[model samples]
Target: MAAAGWAPPRLPGFILTERLGTGTYATVYKAYRKTDTREVVAIKCVSKRSLNRASVENLLTEIEILKTIRHPHIVELKDFQWDSDHIYLIMEFCAGGDLSRFIRMRRILPEKVARIFLQQLACALKFLHDHNISHLDLKPQNILLSTPENPQLKLADFGFAQYMSPWDEKHVLRGSPLYMAPEMVCCQQYDARVDLWSVGVILYEALFGRPPFASRSFAELEEKIRSDRAIETDLVVEAVKKDQEGDASAALSLYCKALEYFVPALYYESDARRKEAIRAKVGQYISRAEELKALVTSSSKSLLQQGNPARELLREMAKDKPRLCAALDVASAAIAKEEEGKDDNDTLKLYQHSLGELLLLLAAEPAGRRRELLHAEIQALMARAEYLKDQMKMREAQSMGKEALAEPVRSTCTLQ
Candidate 1:
């Protein structure tokens, strides 16, 4: 009986064929023009009664964004109309449905396929980035596929999007909790970087068939993103085992990762005794990590000097470009200094200097083999610099924490 009574909304100049989809406040239907061309389009009919003040503003913003932009990967809004009871938006009819259905059909995507999809998504994001627009709600359900054959991703749902500069920060909640950044969930100010974090989660889900947290509760996801205590514990245990086994290089990397998580743990600790205990552990980690930095430096230098075909080839490729050649040489010197077991401060400076030069080079580098090599080198240097930076912070925190622990622990009991 329910199926027998279904009827599409009445609209002029178009013949409604079937119901395509539905949401909380709107229903979409496949329709065709009544003219000779019979142009097909998807009409999103939003009930006027369902929209409040905020939703009306969001709807206007979405229309303005879609009207002004013309990217291949972003959904298009051709026109809009309003009657007594409802508002209608005429959108491009995508034959292949949204990305959520695509992923559900495949269970998991191959790495190559996933990478291609990610590249397309990045192109769309870069366009938005150039315009200073943040699609605060980026999820699989909001990404549509343009066609059934050779389907291309079209980022949709700008209901929560906003024009935000990189340095502009806000604390208002704007996204699904499952894909939101820790800073957003914790009521802390967050900027455009939240989009990058969502992209990472989407990529992970594409490759693995589910998110990293799977079916975990929001609290568990929050802990994983914020404190990361369990992850830190696992990493440090492995780091210690590696250190005992004399693998200084691997241990150093693991220790740095563990130290990054300890920052939050220290910030949230309330008990005096527990804070002291955590600080003692951190101090021990700082000592070993510092020693390993020197050992790893010399070990890496020798090994790198023995064989670094990639670096040598890159240097050779840049022989014609003097500025690029200079940047490559600076990178080489950074490696050499690390290999020579030089001071960590000096080595870190060299790495950062090279990175600044190389990043500039990369932005102007054309699409080709050399450009690909340059990008890879930049990524490697960025990772190294981040690790070194984390270690440096750990050392500073150890000093401050030790000083704080100098005083005797105060009991919670109040004196009468």
Candidate 2:
């Protein structure tokens, strides 16, 4: 939420509860969907007059890009409306406020906290960049948190966003000067890599409470930005090296950085062999990170569950049935290990939802080894679910038994 101290505006279908903030061209409000009270959303209201040609084009681009994307770290655009006077964009509400406000309130986040947000941001950026979308304005203010304590950050405010291919050249200069990449300031043609530079700046600021470059004047800022060799990943590189020297925690910490760097490298690399080499490195790092995290956290169960990279690769390859089976195998193992004995309602509900998802995927998969695997996995999950239900019922009966036994003694005590 950017600082908008304006009066709350009204929309027909939404009940605006609080004014979130205002941007240059729009005001945002926390609103409830009238038809579905449980649905909370942020409605960005912009007057038609506020949009010039460029602004209108930007709005369209944002809508186009957002409509196609579905990632946890990216803010979901639920719906939009164009009225006679204004356009309203309904988005998922971030209860924790924007990253800028969070930083100002807390000064600086701890390393682990910063890493979680940064990792998620990197993932969001990877997804966007993969789809040829560039979120040019990558700053704390444009990043929103799902909650203050939980802190699931969502990328927001895509007004300066652009869709550029590897060969395309972008001459326009936009975004906050403080966080702008050197290439952006130099008027050089840039691609998704510029977003990566902004990620570095944000990460630095999160750790140190200030951006990498601080200048008194715009001219000085531009000079500093252009002169800086590259966004410093020295800290990350050092962490990785330390991890190789046998630091489990450091290894866990550097996992996302490895992933972050790997994404852009893999996406930009034209040579197939080189890309595969990078993929192997990323896979090894991630697998090691999971192992190290498990070692660091001494729990009965593994702290980090394994995700099937093979399945993900297959999905990317569009090998549908094989991907489905891979997904089912992963989920089945996790469920069997984690929820076999748990009878809690919430846990059961979650397992049921997961099984339902697998069922849907299974339906789409063609008949073969993949379909057979899905069927077997689904049956196993169903059996586990029933066993859990039986456990719950037994507990309930035991509780009732105790209550019944106590009733006779209570009556005798009252008579006495």
Candidate 3:
């Protein structure tokens, strides 16, 4: 049931300022910590009455996952408390809203922008898979944008994320129908690859403005998914093929490559081999890029369309002005040289160079002026740097996919 028009119950030491959003099991609110200089956070309140046995089990599982995992792209859980009637979770506030709303508003994001978001998603998923955790619900709705200015993306909503042992089998069929993987639709014992499939669907949606597979009803959606149809790849191919034209095109191409790398192999008989290849490629890319990818896509009509004044201002600040121009030159050279080879050591060196320059830029300003101007500038630069890093990673991932295609086929058939 909805909580009295989306208003969260007030709690001690935390003031509920505004309702953030609501879901089936909980109502999220924007709250300020009174004891910590009014630091803002997102609070999710799940009523005991709203959670069934399975939901409670899920909540516990989420707690376990959150407690054990830590990463820049993952949402941070700060604290949790339970009253007689409900459970409360305090989390970092993502000012930019969820990816679903962003997509609906933007219609579709540029392929380059979408790829940046996907790379981050993949890195986060890779971490989760490595730990044997499957985020059963892997849709745009659960991906939150960290800030409009910085465009950082983070995954949220662990209600359907489950811990899977290496030897265990997954049989539960849950998640939005349009995004469900083939194995999940068939109710077969699946694995972490199912999440990869979901990532493919979401990535497709990010570029095309619609889900890869869609039907009017649940049955039809399931039927479509099981049919193993490959959506038209033309848009992505076109975006990538035009890379020679400019920065935007090159960015788009990298994103297309990342999408191609993670696409589910269900439609292709060579899926298992391809997945292995992708895994190896992802590792190589991660090593080369020296940073995880994170992409944020907002509705085209939102701030993206409004024109980024902060970004524009920074660009102007760096223009032909010799001194500022030199810094840009140094930063660009370091990034370019760092990505010159696929060697892991070279990649780390490049990451360090870029990171140092970034930190230096942040430190250049005096403390008094730092908070208002320098902080925003540094965030923008970091976000842009992150985008470039992801593009390189995308290329590496595609290279791996190509290598997989060259490998001998291996049977992935298994009994549940």
Candidate 4:
């Protein structure tokens, strides 16, 4: 989806070149000084027409913070100027682009390499911490690498940052749900430690190549963060065994199970370094799971088989419930389509429609074993749908590589 304010503004002193990226309220561009030195820079342009009271305050704060902070690891806000139409933040340019693209290009970073980058991030955070500032939106997208070779991490994007002390607390959703701390996400009072939680998530993604709680929606992400770990250790152990035994399907399932706990663990852990270690593991496991999911096209279907038994149990339990039976029938057709190796997208849609009907019924059911069985069946259906989604992504990625069928994330997507 296009963001709110995505227009590029004409600046008198600089020549705006290609677009960089956009956020909810600002669009950044790559520009060069028109003077003798001709230094390259990034200009963040915010359209005045799009700013409300809250966004204006955020823009002001971002300017105030970046202009004042001069740490080597933090992005330098070289200067700022405003016109009748828009607000422009001219800042130092990082050649290698944001960390998200950096990691995507390499697939995953080595632990040693990730450690160096993490240390740079920690240094920048420590500076912020000592100065009583909290960067609430510390995701991979906000971290930039100076150059692809000998890359140096530079922290940027301070629109959600606040000058909260270690003890000061506030209750508001301040950042993206995928990387948000549980306290902030759950709407509890959160302090500077919230940044630490984000730090862990970033570190985890650096290791695993994706966030631990990445989901199709905010609801699913919240559930993963709130749910218990169910002996996450046991899950990782089994995953390790399965991976060694060449069961990619089982291994992928177990790794996802392990990740469901890792997010909550990140919340409660106090020691910073220990949290980083746990987060590192989450990333590696997630990366492996994603890799396994891609290859699931050729791997065994143990998880699919397990989800099948639940489908049978649901059909038996729905003997007296006509609507429930009908939903089960739809689910059966979805399974049939999958077994025939037809269009996975069509099968996924059928499962989604059936699950929608079953979930409403499941919600009203009294506390009993039948309700439990229905819930299990829903989860099974969801697992199948998720597998199909992953299969589609794998195919999409391969096709893009072979035929250049899609736009790269870093290239032009903004409306300006």
Candidate 5:
């Protein structure tokens, strides 16, 4: 249950069909507007009493911000109503789930796919910034994709968003610790750049399959973020250093060095052009890193680190039987190249292989590390699976010549 009121007066022509989601402050339900030809919508119910005067004022401010902006990438707010106990916001429902779930099935999205999604998100952010509105909570869970083929990415859940001049600054910590900018973690005043920092985090996750800073606990995550620590594992450092040593990869090495320098520059300096260039280059590096990391992370080192007996056998087999090892290597390289060239279908295949490999590795690992690794791997695989399923369903509907595709299932609190 959320802090919001559990019940409210039944508004005319609106029939609540199912629960969509529950959050700290509100519960959203899938409902239909019966009077206006039975239009489907998502109604967010918020308790008027649960919110303090300041928070209530903020809600009103959000309403005002929504009313001012009308973009395809921004979710449409249909109506706002309240009785004595609760306030309800009627909005267009996105058939596809949030971005977090989408990312779970696909460990890492390809560069082109991520760029398309980010471009739409960037447009919406730019619109909000132009209006002096800052979406304090900018995470994958708050971003919703409308459908599979026409996956219109829309930003949602603006309850924590605020409006302030670009020049204005306030020292208050807000948003999820994993996505919070370094300055925000330190409780320093930040500008629109804070939102950009969050965008960078999302971009990182899209390419790397995990948040830039991840930890088992919020306290640990906060400390890591506040200290401006990079989540680059030793394997990643070694890979980069190896690349730097190769003359063939010297250009790539320089590009990575420039990107590393740029992250800190945004923290210390306020040069706009330099930041933009850095962001563009960082995006490229993240994409390339995805390909390289996948190869390295799936290699013998990762398996041996988990103490997999099968990996030891596999290694011995490779050394003892050279032809067989070469065949396996060629097969793996071919699959990787195929996935790199593939669009939607290739993405699904890549996820399937990764998921299979992870499960196999997990089964061979000790129990202590197995749980943690399995949880992370499952999250990444599930997100990609959902994305593929959604895409397939949309394609099937189009083949059948349907006027409008059916909506995906909405979240429910319980079986009842």
Candidate 6:
């Protein structure tokens, strides 16, 4: 039923380059867009004959969800088309392959690495949950890596995903058994929390090289999950302790990790109390990094003044602040514009990393007389960030108001 090894000679603007993989009902290929600077994309070609009515609905559902949601950690659906015989879904090409393949190449990842991946996963899940979508199927095979060297993950494959509500009573049995929550395995009602449980399982496997429940049989797996058997792991905590003692580089890295976890919560979260809680965490991560960076900066400055051997490298590091701040200011301004909402996540991430670097530089400045100047600069940056945030809120409000106004017009026209 799949369109395996069936690449058409002429597919409009796309030139099929190579076959990436074959699934049950479709074949994914690397393709180049002829009209757009030959940009590459992963195209999934599915045979129309392969899908029944239910299967077609599922395929459309996936497309609709991708069209509605936009987040950095989610795989992008570049374009899609349907002819008489086939349906093609053009997606972002992830070079590093799937998470499952990554794990196979390296038996187990380090805690710090796993923490970064987990944070990205959490961000994607949080964004989906905010929109009331439940990704019933959450597994390593569905997590695609953007690059191998500096890994960035994008959550893909929404075949079993569905809209969910907090008060919904229906429970459907879906998802892979190995990573499935106990509620799903037991046919009990579940909500968005199931995704969090899957993340926990993934984190455990990433840290320990194996899942907590690695049963040979389905019965055994169900029993393990039902019995509430677990393994305790504190790799993140251990890694954080070590990082806390390190120099500026480690501190800067930690700050990025913190933002990985914080940014999604800050943007998607709705509850006032919960937002305050997340903000406290954000403050804690930033504060610790700033403190550690100050010490590193002061020591380096002292050595540089004495004509230390590593003076050149220290000098380069010191000069990075203003350049980073300038770039951040541009990103912040982009966030203030209504038309740039689609790229807000990327801009926010750039701004966040730059802010962290700027704060590090401020902490490192050893001149007691120049301390107030650095503090004022940091304050100005903070003020700009706050202003951008307010701008985003205003944009959202205006958008909603426009929609509200349009609704009445549509209703009146319909009545006429």
Q: In lDDT terms, how accurate is model 5?
A: 0.66
lDDT of 4 by residue, 1-416 (tens): 22345335678998887778877877899998998999999989998899999999988999999978999899899999999988999999999899999889887777799999999999999999999999999999999989879989999999989999899989978888889999977779988998888888887787777887878988888787876432235568888999999988777777766665565554445555555565566557656876887667554366576555565776787799999999989988998898898988888899899999989999988998889888888888887788787666545533332232122222122413
lDDT per residue as tens, model 1, 322-381: 999988788778777765767879889989899999999999999998998888878777
Clashing pairs in 1: 301-339
For TM-score, candidate 3 versus 5, the one ahead is 3
Clashes of each: 1, 0, 6, 1, 10, 0
lDDT of 3 at 172: 80
Report the Cα RMSD per candidate: 13.1, 23.1, 13.8, 20.0, 17.0, 16.2
Q: Can you list the residue pairs that collide in candidate 5?
A: 104-380, 104-382, 104-383, 105-381, 105-382, 105-383, 105-384, 105-385, 106-383, 106-384
Clashes of 5: 10
What tens-digit string does per-residue lDDT give for candidate 5 at 224-259?
Answer: 765533345333455467666653233333334444
Per-model TM against the reference: 0.55, 0.54, 0.58, 0.58, 0.57, 0.54
Winner by lDDT: 4
Residue 175 of candidate 3: its Cα lDDT?
Answer: 82
TM-score of 2: 0.54
TM-score of 5: 0.57
- Of models 1 and 4, which has the larger TM-score? 4
For all candidates in order, the CA lDDT equals 0.78, 0.72, 0.69, 0.80, 0.66, 0.68
lDDT of 2 by residue, 63-137 (tens): 888888899999999989987888999999999999988888888778888988889999998888888888999
> Could you give candidate 6's per-residue lDDT for residues 15-37 as a string of tens digits?
88777777778778888898848
Instruction: Please list the residue runs of candidate 3 whose C-alpha ends up more than 4 Å from where it truly belongs after superposition.
Output: 1-4, 228-416
